[model samples]
Target: MSKVVLVTGASSGIGKAIATFLSEKGYKVYGTSRNPKNIEDFNFKLIALDVLNIETITTAIASIIKLEGKIDILVNNAGIGVTGPIEETPTDEMRNAFNTNFFGAIDVIKTVLPHMRKQKSGLIINTTSIAGYMGLPFRGIYSSSKGALELVTEAIRMEVKRYGIDLVNVAPGDFATDIISRRYHTPLFDDSVYKENYKANLDLMDAHVDTGKNPIEMAEKVYKIIHTKNPKIHYKVGGFLEKFSIVLKRILPDTWFEKLLMNHYKL
Candidate 1:
């Protein structure tokens, strides 16, 4: 029997890439979206699951278990991008970001843990971001949400080690995806002090995504992790410089690293 895999946020972008690849590779793949009913083009199974809604999360997982009898792998790939100055961004929106990106992933993991524990074997791969490694200018909230998930994976992986359940984080750099269109962007008020700098940074961010690596790179990375006997706690996928930036953060002083990022973003 093929392994059952659940991938959230699979309606497009990196999630879609991972789901489609896994399906083609012979895993029983169930991809999810906020409105799976309308997503008709996917090559694998698509299901309705809104990460923010616990009911949907439970319902979807139950449905998959009923059909497949077990969830061998879970790719927690659902998340949204949130960008704006710390002062200018609405606190409510920031809360929403955390609710979806951080709390939401935890809810899904919590829902799945019991079944995995019963089975005595399971793997969970979380889709985080390269930005999660640091506080990026104007993208602080997005960074924090993903960064929180990264740390949580580290802590929980050990907690559940006895259960034979494995959890790992896959942090991807900017990918050519429609996330910019889907993400929350705080409106720029004409009188706001951040308006000018925010606008410039927004363009820079967009351009990076517009020219980013193909999403398939992430899919490949996830596939490798799934098959590994003892996967590492963290894995990163991206261009040379993007992956190297994490190393730079480790070796360089705090001020030096801050200067490097500022220079990259032209801040």
Candidate 2:
């Protein structure tokens, strides 16, 4: 029997790429989009889901279980990007970002964990970002939310280890995705002192994503992760610069790393 795979936020980008690729490889793939209409011409099954809504997530999982009997894998890939300075970003705005990017993943994970635990075997892959590890100039909210997930992933690994379930954190660098279209920039930036520099820096961030790596490459990396008998705890997906930045951050002095990051964003 083919393994059942449920990929959230599969309407486009990395989520869509992973769903499409895995379905082609013979997994019984079910992809989620907030609106079924946006799923378009996809070979996999489409489920209506709003990751920020717990009830919708419950319904989606129930539907999948009703047909597939068991979920072999759950990919937590639904997230929104938020940008702006740390101080200028409203508290509510940051909470909203956490709701969608961090808590939403947790909601889905909590919903499906029982099924995986019952089966005594499963894989959980969380789609994090390079920004999750290092706080970017204007992407503080996005970074912190994903960074929260990064910490959760680490602890969840130990908790799920006894259940024969695996959890992985894949930090993707800038990928050519609709994330740019979907990103939310804080309105407060307009009235702040960092206006000029922030706008220029934000544009620079978008430019990198505009010419970023392909989503298919990320799908390929995920595919390998799914199939590995005992995959590593963490995987970084993106170019050499993206992956190496983490290492440099690890080994380089704090001031040096800050200088490099500031230079990259032209801050």
Candidate 3:
């Protein structure tokens, strides 16, 4: 029997790429979107899901398990981004970001753990980003939420090791995806000090993503991860500068690294 895989936020972008790749490769794959009707053009099975909705998650997982009898892979790829000055960013937007990016992943994991533990074999891939590595100038909330997710993935790895479950955080650097259009910016006030700077910074950020690696690159990485017997705890995907930035963070002095980022964004 083929391995059964479930990926969240599969309606478009990276999630869709992964689901399509895996399905074509013969794995039984299910892709998720809040509106199932929207995924009809996709190759894999479509499952309606709103990660923020516990009931939706519960029903989606149950429906998958009922058909496949097991979930060998769970990809937490559903997330939303909020951009702008952290201080001016509304509390609700920040909460929505965390709710969708962090807690949604947590909820899905909680729901799937029991089944995976019973089977005693599974892979859980959490799609994070380069932003998680450092706080950006205008995209503080989105970066911070992914940073929280990074920590959550780390802590859960140790807890799930004995259960034969492999958890990895895939931090892709600015992949081209629908997330660009879907991104939510904190309300920008014209009279605010951050208005002009935030506009420029947000545009630069979008340009980076618009020109970044394609989703297929990350999808290919996920395929390799699935085939490997022992995958790394973290997989960084993207071009030289983006992936290398993580290396620099590790070896460079804190002040130097901080200044580099600040200067890059003209903060």
Candidate 4:
């Protein structure tokens, strides 16, 4: 029997790639997105889903369950990014980020866990980011949301271990996704306060994202993990820069790390 997999945020980027790749791998895959009309004749089924809407999530899961009978894998890949200084960011923006990045994942997980618990065998992969580990300037809001997701994944892993379920967190460093290209609704900052510094920081983030890894690379990593017999709790995917960042955080003192980041970003 083919393993059944459900992936969220399947319209594009890593999520879409994962859905396509997994379907090609012979898994009975179902991909969800807010706009499902664009997907047609794909290897997997595309269902309309808005992570922020609990009703939509519940209905989608119910529909999938009716046909598949069992879900073997669930990938929480739906998320958004918000950039700017923490002080400058608005409360609503912070809430929106957390709603989609953290709460949305939680909502789907809660809906799927019951079936997985009954079956006693399943895998849940949460798409976190390197931002979850290291907070970057100008992107603190997005980073904080991912950081919350990291902790949530950790807790879920522990809770679900005894149920014969595997929970994995895929933390990709700066992937080349349309996320950066999309216009962000950032908070308006006071022009008089650190105007030049803020503009420079935003520019640096834009340039960094423009040169990040391809989304397919991240999708391939997700494909590999799904098929592994013994998957680790966390997997990091990226180039040398990602590894270097992790090492720097590990070996360097807090003050030194801050200095390095400041110099790197020219903040």
Candidate 5:
């Protein structure tokens, strides 16, 4: 039987690409959106699931399990983008980001684990971001939320290994997606000290996404990982410089790396 797959946040963007690609590849793919009805002509099944809502997460997972009898793979792609200066960004917004991007992913994993453990086989691929590897200007909250999830994946993978389940993080660089419009921007305040610089960086951020790689690249990577018998804890999919930036951070000294980023973002 073809593997049963669940991909959250599949209403559009990378999540949609991944879901559609896998369905084309013959997997029993089920995608999620906060409002499924709004999405029409989707190639695969779309379920209503708001990652921040535990009840919805549980319901979605249970419905999949009821139909498929087992969920062979889970793509934790449900998340929102949050951009702002840490100091000026409201505490509530930061909390909201963590709640959805971090805790929300965990909740889905928690809900699905029992079924996977019983089957003694499962693969979970998390859609993290290249930004998660470091702190970037104006995108700090977005970076932190994804970064936290990356760390949690590192820890949880080991804990779940004995149960014959695998967890992997797929961090992609900016992709041409609707995320730019959907992302929350902590307003450009008229009197804020960092207003000018923040606006510049925000435009830079938008440009990156506009010129980003196709979401299909990420979908292909996920497909490859699912087929691998032994996949690594982390896989990054993006252009050369974006992937190399992670390497630069590793080899360069902290201050030097920070300076490099400052120059790149023109801060």
Candidate 6:
């Protein structure tokens, strides 16, 4: 029997690529989005799901359980990026980022745990980012949310080990996703105060994202992790810069790393 997999945020980018790749691998796949209408691929079943909506999440998972009978893998990939200085960012905007990136993922895991626990077998993959490991300028909110997700995945992995379920975190350094184009910049702050600072950093981020790895590359890494007999707690995917960033984070002094980032982006 083919393994059953459910992926959220499947409308485009890495989520879409992962859904397509998994389906092609013969897994019984269900891809979800905020609206079923946004789903263009007819290859996999489209389910309406907004991670912030608990009712919608519950309903979607219930329906999937009813139809598929079991879920072999759950990919928590639904998230939004918010860019702004921490002090300039509104509290509400930070809450919204957490709601989608952290709480929303927890909601899905809570809903699916019972099924996976009963089956005593399943894999949960959380789509985190390199930002989770190290904070970046103008990405405080996004980084905080992903950092929270990283911790949640770690805790869940250890807790669910006895239940025969696995939790894995996939932290892509900088993928060529529409996340940058679709990013929400909170304007609640005094733009005039940090306009130049914000613009400089945001521009650099946009440029880096444009030249990042293809979403298909990330999807392939995800596919491999899912099929591994014993996947690691965390997997990093990206270019040489990504690996270097991780190494720098480990070996460099805090002030030095900060200087490096500021100097590199001319921020």
lDDT (tens digit, per residue) of candidate 6 on 131-225: 88888778988998999999989998999899999999999887788887668885634446778778878777888888888899878998899
Q: Give the TM-score of candidate 2.
A: 0.97
Instruction: Name the TM-score of candidate 5.
Output: 0.98
lDDT of 3 by residue, 1-52 (tens): 9999999999889999999999999999999999888555988989888999
Question: How high is each candidate's TM-score?
Answer: 0.98, 0.97, 0.97, 0.95, 0.98, 0.95
> How much lDDT does each candidate structure score?
0.95, 0.90, 0.90, 0.86, 0.94, 0.88
lDDT of 4: 0.86
lDDT-superior candidate, 1 or 5: 1
Clash statistics: count for each candidate: 0, 0, 0, 0, 0, 0
Cα lDDT tens digits for candidate 2, 1-267: 999999999989999999999999999999998988744589898889998889999999999988989999999999998888888887888888899989999999999999999999999999988889988888888998999999999899899999989999998998888887888887654468989888888788788889999999989998999879889988998889889999999999999999999888787
lDDT by residue for model 4 (1-267), tens: 999999999888889888998888889999998978756656789999899999999999999889989999999999988876777777888899999999999999999999999999999999998878888887887888888888888899999899999899998887767887553646445663756777887776677678888888877898889879989988888878776798889899999999988898787
67: Cα error in model 1, Å: 1.1
Looking at model 4, report the run of 10 residues with the lowest lDDT sum: 183-192
Candidate 3 clashing pairs, residues 3+ apart or interchain: none
Which is the better candidate, 1 or 6, if ranked by lDDT? Answer: 1
For candidate 5, what's the RMSD?
A: 0.9
The regions of model 2 sitting more than 4 angstroms off are 38-40, 188-191
Span of ten consecutive residues with least summed lDDT in model 1? 35-44
How much is the lDDT of residue 82 in candidate 2?
A: 88
